[model samples]
Structure formats: structure tokens, C-alpha cells
Target: MFVKISHLYAENFPQLTAPFRPIWGPKASILLVDDKLAAQLNLSPDEILAALQSDDVAEKTVAMLYAGHQFGQFNPRMGDGRAALLGEVSGQNGMMFDLHLKGSGATPYARGGDGKAGLGPVLREFLMARAMAALDVPTTGSLAVIETGEQIWRDVPQPGPVPGAILVRSAASHLRVGHVQYIATMGDDALLSRFIEYVLNRHNMRADAHENMALSLLQNVMERQAALIAKWMSIGFVHGVMNTDNMTLSGETIDYGPCAFLDEYNPASVFSSIDRRGRYAYGQQPAIGGWNLARLAEAMLSIIDDNVETAIEKAQSVLSGYTALYDAAWRDLFAQKIGLFEVHKDDGDLIKELLTLLAKHRVDFTQFFAELGPIFLGEKKRDADNFAAGHFGMDLAVWYEWKNAWQSRRDLESMDEIRILDVMRRANPLRIARNHHVEAAINAYIYKGDDGPFKALYAALSNPFEQREEWDIFDAPPQMNSPPFQSFCGT
Candidate 1:
């Protein structure tokens, strides 16, 4: 069923585009359209194509304002910059998701840069968001990418490869806490109160009765974010930026720019070139989440409780939920990664032990976890011939050393070993967004307009944990010629 979105508040902000169609703006080129999403808007692919080709209002934009911290410095003027809210619709499972456009144009918060996106960043977000959805992550979905048929100057001059990037994206809501904070900094307490009320009414009415509604909302987002972050780590995913404005109050992975997964075990590794200080590093994500939530709390201080102090105390209490929630969520996810069904408290120790082993061996997180099936069955073998059946002897010594503790504790004879093997098979992914693979896709598209490599990558990553039939190249990491990958912040 299609859910209709009404008009945006017109009196407060000036419409930048033609009055006849506020959603229509300076988009240059229109390319691939996702037909599945196009159909949901009661639109056909051809209609969407025509909409892009003409100056039609393809999206119902709801432009929002927000403020946030940039690299630990308070930027009271930050908002969507180049992005605009396209509006919301109810989709699969009664979830109402917002479909917005990025790289549309400069807004109240353009911050002196042309509100444009590079092709690399655009394609990266597209592939990453799709891969994440397949991995069962709550994320913004990519609907389309339009090349403006223009070249944008970045680290140097290059074609945005399209005009500039035009992406139609889907999200739960665009009412970020940073938006509330931005209004607060305007010194209009009434505006802040309205903002708080607007957010509470939209996403967290359950917390409305509480004196500290914003704090209550923060708690909700924290619990969801903790689980989401843990799920990312369990699957070797890295979100290069954990900035406050980028974090949605609705608890979804909002931005996918400059994100990649680990191909080798380096806890401190950062793939985003702009993340030189590792502000959003692998281990620092939880801390960054806490810090970002604190900003959200600070934004709500004006109207959160009856007075200020009580609200501060309430936010402090809620912020404490971060560590406990993250810990529990992480342990549970890692337990699944380790292929354990009935988790005892000792399972935590068991997990840590394996991670320590991985660190020592410098094993690639994805390939190592995925090797569990072959390794476990090798351990249960009655004779050397049985181990050879699965080529489990390729790295026989390291494999045996790893499963030695499992043999000491679990009952391989009493338990169905095949069941355990099956668990391992599903727990670990057969494919992931390896850096080289993404590069291959980009290069293939830019050079030969070849879709074969990307199609194969998508097929593999779509069913990450499943054993696909054409699994030769996808099963293993790229060879030495394509060793490490480094993605940069498109800024």
C-alpha cells in the first residue's frame, strides 16, 4: 500500500525552486532508476525516466535544518548542506521511510562548498547501502544515481563522471537531534520546543509523557545503535564517519560514504583518507556513538525536562545505557559468528580467545570466520583422508590449533557435528564488499561499461552467508596485486 506525504511548512522557509514544483531543482543528469522503488511510488520505471529527463518534481522535498560538531569543533551552522528531504512513504512491513536526494544543491548550511558529490562517493554509497540491506542491516536505501554530465573539482579536477551526483535515498525520518540543536542555537526557545514536540510526536510518542522526552528518545536511539554497531563489527563492516549530523534519530545507517570492511586484522585500520586521526575508527565507534548522543542531549536541554538540571541528569542516566547495550549486543552477535547456539557466560571468554588468536595470526576477519566450516569438519574426522575430503588440510596446522579448545569442551560425538558445520556456514558470510572488488566494479563501469563483474559481486554479497553456485572468485579475497584498499572522504 502507498502512504502519502503532505506538504512541508512553507511559511518558515523560502522555496528555492520554481513555485510550481518545489521538489524540482538543478539536477543535471538522470541515469539508472531502481524499478522496485519506482513501482512503490505508484510510478513506473519509464515514468521515472521521463521525470528525470524533464524538469518535473520527482520527489516531494521537506528541507530540514540542523547543526553539529565537525571534528570536535562545534559548527552551529551545519545543516543538510547539499541534500534535501524528498519526503516519506510506508514500505514493506509497515515501516514509513523517507526518500531524500543527496547532492541536490546548497542549502542554509552549504558551508562554502558547491553542494555536489563525486561519482566515486555516489557509487560507493549505492553499493554499500545495498550490501548492508542484504546483510540485514537497518540502512538508508539507494533509489537512483544521476550523473550531472559535469566534472567536479575535488582533490583535483575530474568529471563527477555524471553531471554532479544526484542520488534519491530512503530513510526512516530526517528529524535529527542536530536539527533540534540548530534551532536551539538560534536562541528561540519556542522554536526549540516546537522542534522537540515535532520529533517526539513523529518518532517517540511513548517517551512523550516523560518530562525528558528528548532524553527518552536518545535512550531509544542508543539501544538500536548499539545493536547496529555490534552487527557491523561482527560482519567486518566499518563506517568511516560517525558524525553527529550523519547519525539519524530514527536509528538507521544514514551515510555510507568512505566505508569499507577489513580484509586483514588491524583493529586500528582506517580506510577513509579523510579519517587521518581515526576519529571514527573500528574500536572508537561506540565512543563516537556516545559522544554523538551526548550532542543530541545537549540540543534538547532547552525543553527536555521541567528545568535544565533534571534533564541533564536524565540524559546522563540514559547515556550509560550505551556500554551495557553495546556489550550485550556485541557478545550475542559474536556468539553467532562463533556458531554457538546456547551461549553460556563462558561464551564471552571463548569469543575473546578466538579474537586474540585471530589477532596473533593476522587472519583476515571475513575469510577466517568463513573457514570455520571446513576447519570444524576437519577436526571431527576419523582419519587424515576424511580431513582431505574438504581440502581442510590446506592450512591444517593453524586450523587444528584454532579448534583445539572446541575439542576440549564440546561433545563432537554426542552432538551432530554436521549441525555445527551448518551453523558455521550460515554464521559467516561467503561474500563481502572487499575494497578491491568495489574498485573493480568502479573501474569496470568507467572503462568498459561492463556490468558483469559488478553483477557477480552483487549476486555474491546479496546472499552473503549463503553458498552460491558461482562462488569461485567471491569465496576468496583478491590476490596480492590488489592488496589493500583506501577510500577517501569525497570532501
Candidate 2:
């Protein structure tokens, strides 16, 4: 079996990459393979493993270079510490996707840490990324997970040296906002110009080179980020670490470390243990998204306009547009979630009230919306009773009051009940990567040497929009535990 791997990015941008080789274990083995994604990449699991172990491919492997602001502080030197770009694979659609190997080995940017990933984090990303893909969110897809047959140290439950593994990540491109920031700080306008052109051509984004090339690039990036973030928020996802480097130019969700979905409807939720001050809190994601984009605007100020003042003005104007862009996307998505097929200006208040009630009553975020469509269609009497018993607890009056108002709002829509329910079922997911369930699945794989739990959850999440009685367990929230849920970077 032959695989056509090309070094397009490394060959085109030599200055942005360092030639490298992946250090593999003595007994590396494939653990999980996404068959659909494998087909898209035009390769089998065996061919992927063969390519990763091939000396000919290792000679062309490279670790990308960039700079980023990690948690509000600028780090001038950062890159793929434990990952290697094997190169690009052209999908069946003729579009090129980068096939990068994570947990491969140390690069020049290792910064004094082992270039290895634990089995737990490897499985977490595999499940999380696939769930996001099934939900139709723009995210980096996982092709396979390879158990490296080595033990690596990590600070997780049942912590000791844990089994090491590698993930094959596929994406539209590996370019990040930090990549642009890297060239912007090199004190070479020609180099930055070339980098910008490379991104534009790679992603096929149109920008007039003669007039304000960087400004045009900024607009394109803002549009993509707006839609991406909107989808994430609608699904209650927190990227945990929204550093400039993690904000990909392609707008796909990359780097799922410390990431978790919402359980209750609390806006102040913070899962990443390192997020001490709540900078990337659930409610703050939208604002933080704009802040990250501001950093990109700062990096592109040079080529945005010849005049510094004009550049600043143009960037600010575009930055101001983020609020409207995000708001529109958010509103449309939320409206559909509640069966508002024809959105009205007052729908904002209705949506706000529902969130307020959920937060106030401590209701399960995913479950509530999942049941709303059926409940609205005069079905799921048991779901209504369960809702009251689980949260409201003998006080159905408040719940019914809000439901009455929402139903009144829906009455205004011209679409019939069936069509309205169709809109809602599509908008609201039947399942999410809930925090406790994810932990249990990880524990099953790491502790019990059992992949059963992980496989069951992955299969349930694959059809996230459909209702299956047996998968009801997947939709349930975690029981009350001693400590609050805290996710790790798993570095």
C-alpha cells in the first residue's frame, strides 16, 4: 500500500519549520482508528502507522515554529514541542489536510519537557474531537490513536507513570494566529508579506494584495472565528485555553486539552485547573474570543495599512464588527434551539429567560434542551416529570410558567409543529462529552484495561442528534462528587 504524502508546508516555509524525526516506542501499536476519517484521508490504519515509522518520511518530518501569548503573557518562542508534521494528505474531495503526529518526540521548542502524551489524554482528545465532528462543529479530526507501549508521567487520578500514546490529527491547515505573530515580530516586512500570502493562497481566502492585504486577511479570519465560536457556545463547549496560538487561522477547534462541555447552565463555569482567575470562563468565552482576535490585529498592524494610525483605525473598525457578527450567529443558533424557526427581535429576552431559569434551578444543560423539542410537541410526559423531580422537585409552577411563555412565542412562528420540531432537533444535541462520563471512560481504558466504556460513549455520541433509549445513560449528568470537576493540560 502506498501513501502520497507531500511536504507542502515545510517545503514552502522552511524558516517556519525545523526538520525532525519521531522517536517511537519499541512496541508501538494502533489502538483506535476513525474509519470515516481514514477513508477521507485515502489511507488505512496500517499505512498510517507504516508512514509514521518510515525513515524516508522521518527525514522530511518537521516541527513548526511560532510565538504566542499564553494566558495574557507574550511568549516570543513557542512551537510544536511534542508533535511533528508528517506532511499533508489530500482528502477524497481533493482538498489538502495536514496529518500531524502528536506525542511523537521533542522538538527545538520542547522547553525542557518530555515529548510524550498519556493514554488518558490521548483517548480524551480522540473522543472529544470525534464528538465535535459528529455535532457538525468545525474541529480538527482525529484519524487514529497509537499506544506507544511506553509509560509517561502525568498528574491525573491514579497518577503514576501512565501509558504513552500518539494521535494522528487531521486539519484544514496547521496555521495559527501565533504563526502570523511570529513573522510580524521578525522585523522583516517582506517575510511577513510572504507569510500572509501563503495563508491566503492555502485557505483560498481572497484578499486584494495591492491594497491592505493584512486588513483583508483580518476580516476573513474574524468571520471564520465568529462562526466557529458561535457553534461552540451553542453546544456549551469551553476550549479552556484560548491562547493566541490555539486560535487556528482556519477557525477549526484545535488542542482539546483542559477542554470540557457544560453540565449545569452556569455561565461562570471554569474547568481548566490552571484558570485561577476565570479568564477563559464559560460566559467569558465570547469576550475572550474577541480579545484573542485583537492580538492578531496587533500582529498584523504592519501590513494592515502603510500609516500606523490608519491601520489602528481600520483594525478597530473591524474589531468592533465582531460583536454584531457573533451576536447574529449566536442569536440564530439559539433561536433554533428553542424552535423559533422565524426569529423575532424579542426572542433574545425569551432565550435569556430560559438560561436564567436553568442556571437558577441548576438544570442539566444538555438534557433540558434535548427534551425541549419532544416536550414542546406534547410528548415526553415522563421527561416533564423527571425534569420536575430532578431539579424543580414538587414545584412545577415556575417551570410551567416559563414553558407557557415559550410556547406562546412559538405560536407566532408560521411553520407547523413538525417542521418547528425538526429545526429544534437539529439545533440541540441529544448528547455531549459530559465531564464525569468522559472521566469514567478514560479510567476504564487506563485502569481496568477496558475499552468497552469508551467505545460505548463514542458510538452514542456519533449520532448526537438522534434519540435512543439505550443511550440515555450517555445523556445523564455526573453524580455530585467531593471536588468540583477540574480538567488538566495533560502536558
Maximum-lDDT candidate: 2
Put down candidate 2 lDDT per residue, 57-108, tens digits, no spaces.
8899999999999999999889999988999888999989998988987888
**Model 1 stretches astray by more than 4 angstroms:** 1-5, 8-30, 35-43, 49-62, 156-163, 208-211, 377-402, 407-420, 469-471, 480-483
Displacement of the residue 76 alpha carbon in candidate 1, Å: 0.8
lDDT of 1 by residue, 224-318 (tens): 77888888888888898777777877778887877888876667778776788989878778788888888888877776676789878887887
Question: What shift in Å separates residue 423 of candidate 2 from its native position after superposition?
Answer: 1.7
Give Cα distance to truth, residue 128, candidate 1, Å: 0.9
| 444: Cα error in model 2, Å | 1.2
Q: Residue 469 CA error for candidate 2 (Å)?
A: 3.5
Worst 10 residues of 2 by lDDT: 376-385
The residue-level lDDT of candidate 1 at 242 comes to: 75
User: How do all models score by TM-score?
Assistant: 0.85, 0.96
On TM-score, the leading prediction is 2
Q: What lDDT is obtained when candidate 1 is compared to the true structure?
A: 0.68
